[model samples]
Target chain A: MTYQSRYAWSVLFRLFHWAFALSIVTLVVTGLYVNSPWTNTVLEGSRSFPMATMRYLHFLAGFIFASAVAVRLYLWLFGNRQEKFWDSAPITPRNIRNLFSTMAYYTYLTDRHETRLGHNALAGTVYLATIVLTLIQLVSGFYMLYPESVFWQKWGVALFETQQQARFIHHLLMWYFIIFAFFHLYIVIWNDIKSPEGLISSIFCGRKFHRSSS
Target chain B: MTRHLDKSHFEPKLSRRGFIKGCTIAAAALGLSDEMVPRLVEAAASAQKPPVLWLHFQECTGCTEALLRASHPDVGRLILDMISLDYHETVMAPSGNQAEKSFKDTLEKYSGKFICVVEGAVPTKDGGIYCKIGGRTALEIIREAAPKAAAVIAIGTCASYGGVQAASPNPTGAKGAGDVLGMPVVNIPGCPPNPIAFLGTLLHFLTFKRLPELDQIGRPLFAYGRKNHDQCERRAHFDEGRFVEQFGDSNHMKGYCLYKVGCKGPETFANCPAVRFNDVDVWPVSAGHGCVGCTEPNFWDTHSPFYERLPGVKIPGTGGIVHDVDSAGKKILGIAAAAAGIHAAVGIGKRIVKGRGKSDEDV
Candidate 1:
């Protein structure tokens, strides 16, 4: 029953986590609004660009989201061993075994919970997928924003061939993020409830209390 | 029944002043600098007019009809007489073997000199038997004529990207001239392209002795450079989110954006808004209809449901699992929400059964 506090998330990681989360939430809201603005209510007696303003805000949030993701990527490449990119690699035989075990635990096929200081194999794999999807979103968003720019016109046209296809992909991928966010929140909350060793607080306070094996 | 062109008889019909005016207008339309006007005039006035061989395939001859209906006085006349116009099946006063003889004679007489203006999609299925002229399939005629010409111009959507004939389940296996010729073809693609586009392209070549700059699809950049949405008069409505939800609604009458009603202007690349069709200040958008993205490749098949914003994505191998993007997205969100709700209910039930009382640590 003995418990020990261990440093987990870094200060920078915590900041990035919030920034990324906030930006993504903002982007989803504004992006959906841009796709189909819900209001025809023009400001009475005043000439204002509501849709344009929404678009600008959306674009700005997109840049912030992209930058946060970039910073996380940099940390994954150059940070401590515990935070290294390989920590999220789901391909190794050991990681694969852990992934299945984690899947089994979540599905209630197994009662044993394998305790880990970092993200479990299944979570790490999902994060990897998120990173890839974020990259696609960034590229597609920027390309659509400045399709006629010289470099993008040449390379982007070669890549996407048309703006409609790029738009379709961008819109479709937003749903993926939405679905992922739901599952992510549920898992995090469920895990914290199951093991009350500062599971949720670790992200905020950079430390987690784990039950000592002894 | 072949009719000989009496250049002397036709020369007097177009005044030097009218011809020069047409050239200037054409030069401007072609996106050439004002300085290019003199060159255009010279090109037009030159004794040796550029020969043109007009070819028709699987088409409705709408493009020719549009050209004939040019609003500017003498524009139609200039288009017809300014070029040698060696052969045009629609306008030519010849038929049967005489027409065939005229086409052959013109092709040989102006080899490596004439411009090949193809006006329709070339059918390739069943050896292009769907469309034939003078015992030759469109494929055979294009193959023979395109390579020998100094330049090739695909005058309408059909000639550019197979148009309506190439729509889904295209039985005729119709294709554009560029696909058939296996060479770059200057494409001026509209359902029935603005005749001015064709005129400008022709004038540009005649004036400069080379084709104008083109976009990825071989469409003259001047005409297809900016998107239709960019120059649309109703763009302010789009920006303000004042859209026509349906045809003939109050907003539509107020000239609101047609986006919600399936205007493809955003995706369509053309100068339709800038240079209104038939020289009138009205385009499809102005006339209260959404652009069908007629200038784009595969418009008929890809840009369908002209009243919808986004086209449905057809699932492969499925008989018909075409999903509208907006609805599909909403469904996914609904499913995710439901799943989260179910999982939360299950978790709460488990917690209640286990007697693990809710603690402040749950936050």
Candidate 2:
């Protein structure tokens, strides 16, 4: 057997991927703490803002997560053909067929997944949905920051009707990310082992291994 | 009928100083400049007081009690001098047929000119038979009067968003006045709303001849403009992360933030912190109890399990099965993890068996 190492991900794509993942992790950790503070650092006559600190970190990471999402969306529109959204995401009829085939492969109805360098159609669609969820989380978060501000009041607070409603939506989505992270890790690791492509390393090194001949 | 002697009987006996002081407080509450005090005084002294027909439905009269309890500038004098209380069910001197006649006369006299203040939830279920006053359902009464009034004010949470009566399993199908009337009504939503908030709204209407600026929920922005957390006296404690762990702990004595013990201040938008109830510098948070978030719409349902950080989500179609969000989230994640583990084990096992068979063929 012979294999070829091909450049699969753009440098910017890799950067956005890592930034998004890191920030999402940071956000979930800090957000959970903010939702229900587990630590009570009440020293005698002492003052510390663990909740405030967690919130500040959460907000800071939220901005980074939003910006990373923006970069990914921009790359989807204008990037190397492989990095473009359509390369993996099933938008057209042919791609939709590929998506079902990929699902069949995952469900063990088929022994083979279609050969693709980037995300399989199902993964791509899930990522697209994730971007949408991230946007909702951002809107909900930003609205709560300045509930009194005219801009947010009109767009965020009023739209949600109450700050708690927005908070609930935001909190609900946090669990989604947690569940997503679990499935995401398991599947990606499975791919790294089972698939011919250097799946996991491709994210870090921007290269994938493909069988040249066997 | 003997001709009523002493026209002064109709006039409120307010001392000029107290009247001026009251005007100042009103101006402040209305977010008007100090210069607006004289204008407020002038508005109050003007002979043409707006006729207010206050209606009570499924309520405890707490809003009225709070209003009457205002001591500074004497809210009793303010209410009497500023607006002609045409037909408050609780405070009216007349009763039975006389009271009914007064309400009828006010409706006739002040058609399209009066302020209709509704103080409780209106029931619409079963032909609106849940709450009745003088043989008319609250729904019937509000519908008859609200459209005719210049403006409608839904005082207290009950009138604003159906309060406790409209909470889940709302057997009577209680709804707010605005919902019942199907028109915009100014909502002053608190369990027992601060008199200052109501006074501000009243004074704004009297002085400017228009309702004050209202938020999306139809609450006066001057009062419901900021969240209770923002103006909280113990805000420093919140920022500093000092919270009351329990009701009687030392932290409580230190006046720490009540966020930990389920203070809904962070979500509640009310001026309770800034304008304490009863003309004293004391609100629920100030008195060492966390805010119950009485002002926000649907507070009874949304802000309940009130002593907790978050409301328990009632699982739909589960026949009243309620679980805390955090616990439910953890359980969901745990289930996902276990499923993922099982899937991985199956996938890995299949791969090992397939690989062994393929390697034996190569050997």
Candidate 3:
């Protein structure tokens, strides 16, 4: 494809991007207030409105995030066939080797190798792990939240009498994201400095300077 | 009728007015006021001291300590004076073999008539060798005495559920009176049970001539009827999630609930919050440490590491954590995508603003 017409993110993925970010921010702020680390007064002094609003907002944001993730999952499953979304994160040997090599290359261990059109190998595996972790967190979180509903209560809390069990799992999930964020920042900065190109703007403006295949 | 009533100028030492005034003051202090005055007066006049045999075993004399510190002077004295105490190991001037002889004699004299009040645990290990009085194990002595008594009152945690002695790896096999004696044992359990519970049960029995209704654990339903969390004054703090994180912190001093710091009050059944202790007006939680759940069964074993919370028992759509933000679980997707997109986009924004190559590393 010509440089001007190079493929980037589809409209759905771009929309999903902004929506997920907004929802995440909302959830974090609201979640902290709900089980406040500072003071339980987040909902205090409100005759009743703020607490009820936070509860509603928390659930609503979760719904939006869940829907976006679902759509993204579908896109991963059935995009284009050959070099489609499936092949982007393939478990092939070359990709696996590249994943390790990319990690090594970032640490200045060796010279860089040829790049793939889609996600690098290490990126693909992390993607799978993140997806799996998010799915578990979502299910367990929802299960714990309303464990008493005809749904969660009748058959949920019995699985774990102590809320501590779920808390441990949930806390562990947070560290994963933070670690991922650190590595992600490192790689992007390193790549942008080396290339000096507009590779970063592809998601926003739907355009990029595509390098020719050897 | 012979005029014998008119002949004697001598009256007994006590005057009627002084005694009545003393009782009225006592009844008021017990929080039972004028409306309840007639009942108290009638009860005091009609009732005799309930015959009691206070037994001691593996104990610290704490229940006795709590009872002695009773706020109402009359109630404190009433338990001692009104009742013919037949035998009490601690307060009775008699000791050793002489005391032993008195206990046996009283058991015979008041068999099936006196209330058997047990104050401590009975070590059943190796036939109760852990604790002894008068050269006989508390177990052997109690087993012989229990069946003949009219009613058995297990007065403290030690006698109620073996107290601290029955904590994990209980080497002596300390057992409560209920388990050791086949008789009906009414448990007034606490590390040292509130004195009012003991007095209330005793007085109720004297009036009714029957044991009060007890829960499965032999605790009187009237006193240990509800979980401490249900009636605790700081309970709203618990439900609101405003917790005191440390000792002497502002929240602790402000009277916040101790549930966050491992107060087992929510799960424990007792009225300690209402009845209080030693009439000091503040208990352990008020002192900033959480409730150790001294009254509940297996309290020592089940509720340990006293500062950490009991795994929060989520009630589903009720009191529960709202999200997966413990570490970073909740924002997984956004982070993954945003890191990818933001850093990429930040690269572009830098290039447009700074005109490319002269700019800083995207790193």
User: In candidate 3, what are the lDDT values of residues A1-214, reduced to their tens digit?
Assistant: 2233366566776676667667666766775544444455434444544444675787788788778677667767755332244454546776677777877755444444444445566667777777777776666566556533335433333443223444445545545645565665567566656544355665576444555542
TM-score of model 2 relative to the true fold? 0.93
Which parts of model 3 have CA positions greater than 4 angstroms off?
A1-39, A42-214, B1-48, B311-363
The alpha-carbon lDDT assigned to residue A21 of candidate 1 equals 87
CA RMSD for every model?
4.9, 4.8, 13.0
Error of 3 at B299 (Å): 1.3
Enumerate clash totals for all models, in the order shown: 0, 0, 11
Residue B136 lDDT (model 3): 86
Error in Å for residue A16 of model 1: 3.9
> Model 1, residue B45: what's the lDDT?
75
On residues A1-214, what C-alpha lDDT tens digit does candidate 2 reach at each position?
A: 5668988899999999888889989998998787767676666446567777888998899888889988998999998978788887779776798889888767655566567767778988898898888888888888888788778777775557678778888888888888898889988887776665778888999999866545
- Give the Cα-based TM-score of candidate 3 against the true structure: 0.54
For candidate 2, lDDT tens digit of each residue in B225-270? 9999999998877766777888999888988888889999999899
Better of 1 and 2 by DockQ: 2
Cα lDDT, model 1, residue A170: 84
TM-scores of all candidate predictions against the true structure: 0.88, 0.93, 0.54
Using Cα atoms, each model's DockQ against the true complex is 0.38, 0.46, 0.09
Tens digits of per-residue lDDT, candidate 3, B99-175, equal 87888887888888888999989999997888988778998889888888889899998898888889868999999
